[model samples]
Target: MHQLVATPFGGRGLILRPGSTKAVQLPLARFEELRALASALSTVPQWLIGPVRAQWNVDLTSRSVGDAILVREAGPYEFSRATWEINLGCDLDCSICYLGEKKFEGLDMDGKRKLLAVMRDAGVIWLQITGGEPLIDRDFPESYQIAHEMGMLLELLSNGSRLRKPHILNLLRTFPPAKLTLSVYGATAETYDTVTRRRGGFDRFREGLEQAVDAGLNIDLSLIIVQENAHEVEAMRDWARQLGVPYREYANISPTIHGTAEPLPSQSPQYLTNRAPFTGCPAGVTFFHADPFGRASICKVGREPNIDLIAEGVEGLTRLGGIAESLMLRTGGCSGCKLSDSCRVCRPMAKVFQEAKAPLVNYCQHGMR
Candidate 1:
């Protein structure tokens, strides 16, 4: 497992450690020095070592410099981040899951390896490994290990269903993610199980969270507020606070990637949170999302025009910038709206809501206000 990573991103150098969000800026001179000592585990001078230890308590004493400390050369692609959905298969069947069908399908081990290589070569410095539940995938461990080996900072998104398992816990302990985010449906068993529509789900979730916390893994909680569990939102917030991990609340539910309205009924309209106005986003420009089959899209929410990274390879990404611009054009149902300047949702999101025939209040400022 790599203890620390040193890489160039966005015209600057960064030194990052596993299981920690703190990053140390690597000077051009020091960064080039490590690049020169490519084959040898040379001694790290005190000038550089002192601050790293202070920030993350990582000692460079016995660790290999050239090997343990992964040093990656800057790549041609300007992309510094990506999100990959390993598989849509999830353990629980939640009523409001954005991934409507939650089908269990994806690439084989070889294809997955190829996709990760493409991400690395494209300069994806920060990667989020997610799924309906990524832990359930058989190839997840190896895929994660491979990405970590290639010097990408990893973050995981899961439902906390399998975090208690010895195998999953041990794997995480060995090669820690920079952050692990889990979705919290409710604070108690009855509300939790009702929302998930699965028996004993709350018990399993609590156990998993306990084990993960005990293992000292970096964790973030996502408080999911839906109609089934809306009454328990405060209880959920209190539980997350007591657990002492960082958390954020989400009340807005959306249509599926295919623009279906199945998940809309699960939303609690009265409990919805206010949304900020839509602004320009750097989706295809700086970051992209890869689905299970390795098709790269501008982002998860904007999926229509995508690149087949598997068939065309990294060079195909060049077309995405134009695709993003075309997709962002406000010429659909939103074309001449007087409030288009302050609309809360982006074009891709509004298009899906329109497809789902959702109530305008859900996304349009005209109805909402």
Candidate 2:
């Protein structure tokens, strides 16, 4: 695994690395040279070490380009980011989970390794490993390590249930992710446990979150503002500020991916925030989501006609852009609706809510206004 990486992003040259937030912009000429050297497995010129040092505060221990730097080859695909659901399993039973069902099933180790390889070839620069709590996946450690080695800037989405484990901590320290996001169900144990329906869930979450903070990992907090935990929203924000970690609030809870309204009952009416108006998105164009079984979709909410990556491999991804167009263009109940100019939810999300027979006010502008 290379210690540094040089790749093209949005027509610009970027130099980044694992375990650090700093990135250096490279001139096109220099970026091409580095990319060539990486492809050739050649030694890096003596000059690169100086800039790397100045930018990232690290000294290259090796001169070999393949060892000290991973020059990402420009791929035919335009994808720059992706999120994989390692597994749908979870140790907690949060009432507001969007995945709908939490089955502990996904690609096996060999299949997982293949999937990561495909992502690297497809030009994924930023990869988010999410789940019903990804850290609890049996293959997460090894899969995470392999992805880091392959030069994708990794991000993790979890519930802070397993971050305190020594092996997990050591693995993270060794190949740190670009960001580690944990969702705060509640600030107090009683409310938190009640939200998760898991005894001792709050204590475990606190333990793991504190350990992550102590490790100096790049951390973010997702304050889940649902009915069960809305009372603790302020306390959660204060705690996050006290810890000095970045925090964002997600006050909207929608129907599950399966188009089930089971999770909507937990929505806190007073806490519901207005969503920005529906606009264009780049879901299948530059980004996509992969479920536990390696079914690729434009996004989590639009799972139909998914490509089975394990069976068809990376070549199957070529059809996704067209699929994106087909799905995004179908406005469902909002088709030709004059209120669409003010509607916040997108076509896929609107479809899910419609399938669940959700109250119009929950997602439609007609009721919202």
Candidate 3:
């Protein structure tokens, strides 16, 4: 096991071992300083240096400690983080689900364990367990425990409906995720129910949030901006503030994983129209996603399977680097467009539009301009 684990927030911290109970928090800079001092001293015990050297893949003789730990570059086949879609069986039929009305089929417990092992061996440090609703997965408790035992920093992304259940709450208390991100659809029952189209979703969400807080779990609230819930955005923020929980707003909506624009209608047009320069995408490079069936892709939005992780294993991930490189290159009409300067459009979506020539009016705001 690695002596120093990377936190989800991008800092390095020590997880005390040898029958230890908890992680010891440390700042990145300070951890680096200790590592440097330890590396320089020949008198330091081998037991102390062994784990750090193995974890960072340090060459003590040739490379400086600063150089070794400063930047972590992933090899072609390696990934730092992975998002595993445990199941697609969400209880609430929200107006803006990226997967739309997808059928839910997940790996059996044994298969799931194998997949987790593959990810761990492939060097995934942070594993995000997401779903239509992760807590609803019948095998979630065992799966969560297995991942935790494998030394992966886990993040649970859920609608927070089932989290109110005693069994689920107990599971969280026993092996807490590094972070629990709950999706808040609206500020009140009326607005939330309107978006979810489920009668008691808001109540269940509230109850779940309370249960998680009572369990002393780290919680983050994410508000999805859509036509039904846009009016209550500020109120939702205020509610998160009142609860003293960190909150963020997601205004951008993407097409379904199947390449259909089902959720596009629910998106706020004003939000789509606002443009920014195209920064780089991290998909297939530092991050990857695996669907319920173990098909791997660069991201959720770009669900063109680059590999079948269940069949190919780590070798398949190497092919993703070339795929990622190709996806980043400009395609079709995007190559010489005047609006390219301020385009916020991503390459995958651009490729979709280019091939179809379908005027995704909201997505192609620059075209209208």
The best candidate in terms of lDDT = 1
Per residue, candidate 1 scores C-alpha lDDT tens digits across 1-369 of: 567888986556788987788898977787888777645657665666887888987788655577557888776777888999999999999878888898989999999999999999998989999997999999998999899889898999999899888988998998889999999999899999998989999999999998898898999999999988888988988887888888998889999878889889988888786679987888998899999999999999899889999998989888889999999988778887888788898899999898899899888978866
How does residue 278 of candidate 1 score in lDDT? 86
- Candidate 1 contains a number of clashing pairs equal to 0
Segments in model 1 whose C-alpha atoms lie over 4 Å from true places: 62-64
Considering every candidate listed, which one attains the maximal TM-score?
1
lDDT by residue (110-134, candidate 3, tens digit) is 8898788778767776789998888
lDDT tens readout by residue for model 2, 218-294: 99999998888887889999999999999999988989988999999999999887788988788999998998888
**Deviation in Å, model 3, residue 188 alpha carbon:** 1.8
| Positional deviation of residue 58's Cα in model 2 after best superposition, in angstroms | 1.8
Ranking by lDDT: 1, 2, 3
TM-score of 2: 0.95
Misplaced by over 4 Å in model 2 are: 38-47
